[model samples]
Target: MSWFRALKDTTRSGLTVERKRLEPLIALRGTAGLAVVIAISLSLFGPAVAAGSAFGGFQAAIATFQRSWRPRPELALASGASLGVSTFLGYLTGSHLFLFLPLLGLWTFLAGLSWAAGPTIGIIASSNVAMMLVTITLPTTVAEAAGHAAMMVFGGLVQAALVILFPVRRWGAHRDALADALAAEADYARRLRHDPVAEFDPAPLMLARSAAALTPRQARTRPAQLHGTRGVAERIRPVLASLADPAVGVPAEGPERDRARELLAAAGSILDAAARAIRHGTPVTIPPGAIAAFRTPDNGTILSGPAQRAADRLGPLLRDVVETAGGTLPEEAAALPPAAALRRRLTRPRRPRAGPAARPPDLAPLTAAAPAAPPYRDPGRPLRRPTLFELVPAAVRAIRREARPGSPVLRHATRVCAVAVAGYLIGGALPLGHGYWAPMSAVMVMRPDFSQTYSRAVARFGGTLVGVALATGVVQLAHPGTELSAALAVLCAGLMYLLMRTGQLASQACVAAYVVFLLGMGGETWSQTVPERLVLTLAGGLLATLSYALYPAWETPRLRTRLADWLGALGEYAAVVVDHYAHPAGKAGPEVRAALLKARDAHIAWQDAIDRAGTEPVRHRGLSNAAADDAAHALHHLGRVAMLMEAHLPERDATPVPAAAALADALRTATRDGARALRERRVPRWGPVRAALEAWDGEGVPDRVVRRGAGMLLEALEALSDALDTDVPPMTVKPAHETDGPREP
Candidate 1:
């Protein structure tokens, strides 16, 4: 009697726990039923509805998800999970009840649209509830509501079982991703060293370069193990302070202090180079001078001579890399060639030609080299915030140019709306007796960014397959009752949260698991139903792909026009640098910096646009083998000129030559050539400008100005000519230092 009582008590306890779990589900079912009745009654008694409410829900969810998900993988996972969870909760509350089924179908469709736009666990749960409610409303029976609720309980249980039992491996995947990124960076860096003007915005190249520099040991370490080396040079501050004190006895601090400072400086440079390389995707070579100083024997006294020598060598290199990376140049430097002595003379400053009547500025009167401007001060810190204003305008322009003239926004919106409507009508008309999948297909097919479209489709399919399989297995084994069902619901909620923390794949898996649970909970004894759900999902995916591929919205194809515009802007900037250098006595400040910043921003944008264009499969053949190569070369020359201008500003400002006219003439010639190259799709003539700048005598021009302007102009002309000629194939544009040896001081 005692044993029997104990058994009965255990059974009762289990039953009570199960009953408690079922309460929320019951309430959820009741709410869903009530919502459907309201929707139907409104549809029948009032004006006929055309599934607006359903479509709206689908649109809102897609917009919300797309807006939130970014390129960063971690952020993508988190946002996807959150949306999933939020969606599930909405179903539980029966909020937006009429739209719930539509959203579910939409989620299914988006999964096919792109890997990045797939449905989450939350979406699956919401869909299940919505479908159940829609079915229950067909009979308008209280018994139907109870039956659906019971089914939901069963579905939830099956999902819970899978989560607890399944072992998901994530660490390996993360490591692989990191490794791939690093490898890519390394390859890019190697390429940049060989060719620097191949592309603009070396950030990708630099990132790859920096990652390559990392030893295998470093690469293998977990993210947690790799302590952020940000501001690591700050640690050397105390040692620098100790060495600065003159009061300390020379004997006590001499050799050790000297060695320490040398190492610290070298280390600092290396760290800075590493940071720049990573941020800009450019390679940065350490100067030999710094290496020599760092290798000095340990001595306490500050090794002023060696340290100074190393610093001197490093200065020019550092400045060049920074300027190149930033897309700025000085006024007078010759086009960059092998690092060697190639003296160029400065021409006298010519007065601006007075309209058409003004005699061309006289080149007969050669001037002494212009005085150099003050050495440029480092901006101190790198610009971190990406300029969105510039990006947005460019994007808008591209979109407008690419779109059919007039009401692009309206056109796009109309097309999207049409797709949605078509999906809805078709889904409603399908004999499959479920109208959820059609609207889902529409949502998936409509996307602005095409890069992730394929991946999204694949992930969606894979996730669904796995989810259905798991659901099928659990339903067979559990034979879910109220207790089992309640347990499953709670488990699903927890898994949804966990999936949100994982990645897109995991999140999709959780959703799939939940869907499987729903199928089982509805008291459908046929396991074959899982296959039907899979087929429905695939159908939705296929429809989405067709929509994207057929009537796709595209970015503008006017890449050459954009490139020409940038070159023109660069010419104007070059003129500014030359003008500043011509007046040696002029003070240098924010103007130069501002010009440099603008040039940098423009260069980056140019590169980004090119990348986008390259990714379009239809345009790839055209882009890969077109005059883009020549155009890129010309831009590279412009970039070098900008760097040289910054480097020689001090010297240029001090020069006294009146050769401003010659400088202006050369700039005009180069600009015209660049324009012609773009118009005719041929290389520009760079020889005349190069020869003139190189041959000009700096006798009357100030030496400082001559040295600065001559070097920059010569280099600019060479680059422009080379770019136009197409004799030299375009290489990836690297940050200045990465391509060449360390920049000259």
Candidate 2:
């Protein structure tokens, strides 16, 4: 039961979007689109190769239909080029065993190199491999090979035309990314108002980060500049978090704190307005004093105290947001609240906090984005990259990068090439019919990491057996003609495409049906091909699994390095943000942004490593899973706090706080020492961090500013220490009232 509960704790069901609910409509569109292309080809080639052309059309559509707006010409060209090269290799390898084996290994090896460019290029490479694996074992000459490749290209052209004509959601991804972030911010703000120091789930923020990943190169800009809607979303998270810092005394026992909470609530209202404005693409209309209210502080709060500091931090950020959001500041900045009632109707109420088991669905915010530039391009225009001329140099560079001994891509590619060669040899040395399926299956099943490889192998084998039986049964029952078989193939292709994002098993099942029906249209009967396909697929999966079992890409060896990397980056990020607070001179420069990006990248890398390691074999060395997870959770919490610290980073130069500077230095030292300890196998000291915060007396104005930041930092650091030093489950994070008291490290 305990293990089951832990397993549940780790599930990220919150991140998933329910695509299955919309699959039926997606399937219909996909089927109709592919069928139209295939129907035309049937008239030209009839049954001889109509099936191949149709399958090509299906594959083209499936591969190219991503969240972003792809240029139709680029899709047609990339697909055609991949098909052309893979076809040449397939034809070359079909006859000559001596030359074929070595070249096949080399080709697979090179294909792995494609990953360095990006996943977009990586997908193209993998598709090329898959196509060739199917084509190479075919009984065809050079002339027939050209015809087959042309048919594939023709199929791609059809899909491209469909895309151009249909013109579906072009800016959907960017829109969703922005909307999700704002929604999450609103949710976080709502929770903050309820319980300023509560341990809120960080999953929604993670979801927003993941959603905001598809940044357009054209949209890249300076720190003060608005890159995209995502940039605004990123900026607002810290503001919301800082406002809710319990140790900052924004909600502590005082009239001044009460006033600060009201201001925080007002700031939240502005966020709501911004979210709504972005959602509808309207100019922002905040309450008259919303912007000005933050600028002019109430004199009742102690000078440079928590209330004054929170207001000081939120002021410039609010002003920047107003400019970015295209909001107009009223001439009389003091007439606040009720006057902004016109805009109030446009905003939404906060959602009720979800139960623990409630998976995150979506968020809608009421805030605005800081817009610094006009749109890079018209939203209606489909974005395109520089074409294939640049690919040669990129591919060469990728190969060079992958040649490094420690490169993950190099290791993975080597494994794939070795496995492919082995499967090909085993198939050729036996009596299996068109045994290339074995090699194809092996390559397809072998993922870069162990978890994916094992999972995919199981899915491929099980889905194939089930699919073969089901497809064969349907074919025997219907005994359809050539045209009907072609239709069935198209239908299967469409359904497979729709189901791909929903479930791997369902997609694989449809793939089996599609293949069976497609080959049947080419005069290969189900009875003759089903057994061969089944046997080869099973063999391929087994071979792929056994290969990994023998020489596993275990995450244990990489886990320590990743953890150290994350800690180092986190420390740097925290220190930098702290320094900016201590010395807010030129806060609008690029240095802070650069540091934040590095930290975010490192955090992502560590999480990815943890996930992959979880999928490896159970006998992990160097560290246990529970300890690793706790460590990651600790770091993630630190990262969240650091992000908040960054959001409220002061904009004007201030007298440096000695205590704050000391704490900053301590963060740097601890990170360096901790990383070294983690890597070299030692228990790192947390004394410096705890001691620095304790000795910092909040005596004067400057020290008070430092105290606010130091207080929050100490609490976060202590949480990190607790997670690292103990085996306790994470309980509610209350304010650490014992910062000045003796503590166990």
Candidate 3:
């Protein structure tokens, strides 16, 4: 892609409006917190101090609004406390340029490195740097600076307290996530009724799983309705696919197909009803038609053998879904109180009993055999979020890991530090009084990727212009007092919070206006602040954007490494599943689960890398676009085959597939070497896999399904090798450290 097209696409994306629901109540709460902080600071310390402290409440509120699984109060407190510390430290060095410039570079670099932790941390840390730049200009002694810092912390505390006292829709994010997953499954089922081979995106289920991970306290206090639904949802997806697929369950078209379609339609209805109930925290009201379809006995006519078994498996899972949704069983709707029963009947009309209502003999049990609180437990690494205290060490380790040469985090830090210092020097040399705006803008807009940095540069500049113009107009026309300025600031902040999800351009515009009013409250006239801010913001944005082109960290070059990682992870997952087949007594053990989780993470990472690489204005050096797509498709097939095998895992005492042992070992060894070969820019060979499969030829593996799945895996691997070998040429790429050596401090 050309630079022009990349820049154009990124700018359009940044400016695009997302029609997300506005959180008016949450915005009001944040704005109210800011209002309180401004009122307190003005009453006690005057408008300038109020202006300085407002960053705490504003930034704290913004932090809480980030898409994080952590509690809102915690995010608020951390944002406030960090800003206070950054302000105090900035004050200590503000008197001397020699001292302050180094401090500025160090702080900005640390802020850049914080991205290694997560986007939330990176964003909050950048805001801290900006707060420091703004607040250190307040002209105060060490004692006075400490007092101002304390007031800032107080502002954060106010926001945190408000969040704890008046949370709007508690656990709302989790509810929406799980609801969306169920809704997605419902849609998939409806689609499969027509197209049996319809593809389903696992992103929603992945997000639902992420939302399920909880802290120890959260685990104990979680709502009962949330438990076990996700697992049942996970199990239902494969069953739906199995029931619909022509090769696996029913024929292309017959009475069995019609029966399958009925079951699918009913499943979709049941799932959609459950989703609605869970999302609204109301009683589940599954359709009476759905209830009847599941209870109808085939009598060995409609769906037989595997199709019948899948249908049977699905019925109990759907029942489990409704039960876990709100414990509103099909048979118990009439037993509720008059109003409740009426509501249930309106939505979940009673269905006639099909038989004794006894649970099917072949029905799979729920989590009864496992620990009681399965849903609330901290899942494995990908979904397991660390507590704030735990995060300190984890963050430290992350920074240390990214400290080496070739690390994108390190490169970003270096580039940001360099640009910030240069922008500061240039701004200071110019006549603009607000020299910090230039460096602050540069720091805030820069990210590890090209698209965000460029897009944000456009957003920040455009937003700054509109914001300055509007605030200047308001100031000149109304000639408002300190109190009115504070009110306007709060209003702008509320708008910012409300539009937080509506893309960067919109929110940044409000942010610009808010800052203007904040400074106006500090007694700075529009003339003194407006022009300086506008000019300095432009300078800073340009510096940040230009620095990327000079010191680029392209994802295109790292595509092979990411693809290799995915291959290795996928192989391990396949081997683990095959190993389980080899030793049926083990079932799906922790190792298998862990491997599966790792592979999924790797898959997500690979897709993310591909996406990032696609937007970059660089050539595909090692892997072309077609090759990547083909390889991705092949890997996806490999994952699906493994998932199918996992769905049909043998019973604990079932006859073991002796051939699976050798096949699993070969997969583990061959994929390990294949990944290495890919990394070294050589075509991968699956000779071991071929040999292992050949050894079982004509011997007939005890489990034909396992053998078939293993054969599919081998085919996928071969296809992947062919995809890579067709276009990939031999090349020696330098290690990241060698290519981008770390600068000496």
Query: What's the TM-score of each model vs. the native?
Result: 0.48, 0.77, 0.90
Better of 2 and 3 by TM-score: 3
Give the runs in model 3 whose Cα sits over 4 Å from its true position: 328-384, 733-745
Report the C-alpha lDDT of model 3 over 595-648, residue by residue, as the tens digit.
887887777778777888889999987789999999988888788778767766
For candidate 1, the 10 contiguous residues with the lowest summed lDDT are: 736-745
Per lDDT, the best of the predicted structures is: 3
The whole-model lDDT of each prediction reads 0.39, 0.60, 0.80
Runs in model 1 deviating more than 4 A are: 1-201, 204-269, 272-310, 313-416, 441-446, 479-507, 514-533, 553-556, 583-588, 619-626, 651-653, 656-745
Q: Which should have the higher lDDT, number 2 or number 3?
A: 3
Model 1, backbone clash pairs (residues 3+ apart or across chains), number? 117
Candidate 3: what lDDT? 0.80
Question: Per-residue lDDT of 1-745 in model 2, one digit per residue for the tens?
Answer: 2434422432222122235544455456557767876777678766655665665666677656543323444555577557656776677666888888887888788776666665556566666786677754442677766776787787777667766666443333444555556666666666766666544443444444444433244223111112333454555566556656665446455665565566666676666665555544455556645443443435233324443544554543554344344433434433333423334334322222211222211111111211211111112212233345655675676556556655667667887788889888887777767677788888876766665666677677666877788889888899988888887888778777776776557777888888888888888899778887888888888887777766665665667667777788888888887877667754454677777766766666666776766655545545567777777767767776676666555656555655667778999998888776666544456788877777765334454334555566666555655555643332233211100100000
Residue pairs of candidate 3 with colliding backbone atoms: 406-736
Rate residue 148 of model 2 by lDDT.
Answer: 69
Question: For residue 401, what is the lDDT in candidate 2?
Answer: 52
Candidate 3 weakest lDDT stretch, 10 residues: 366-375
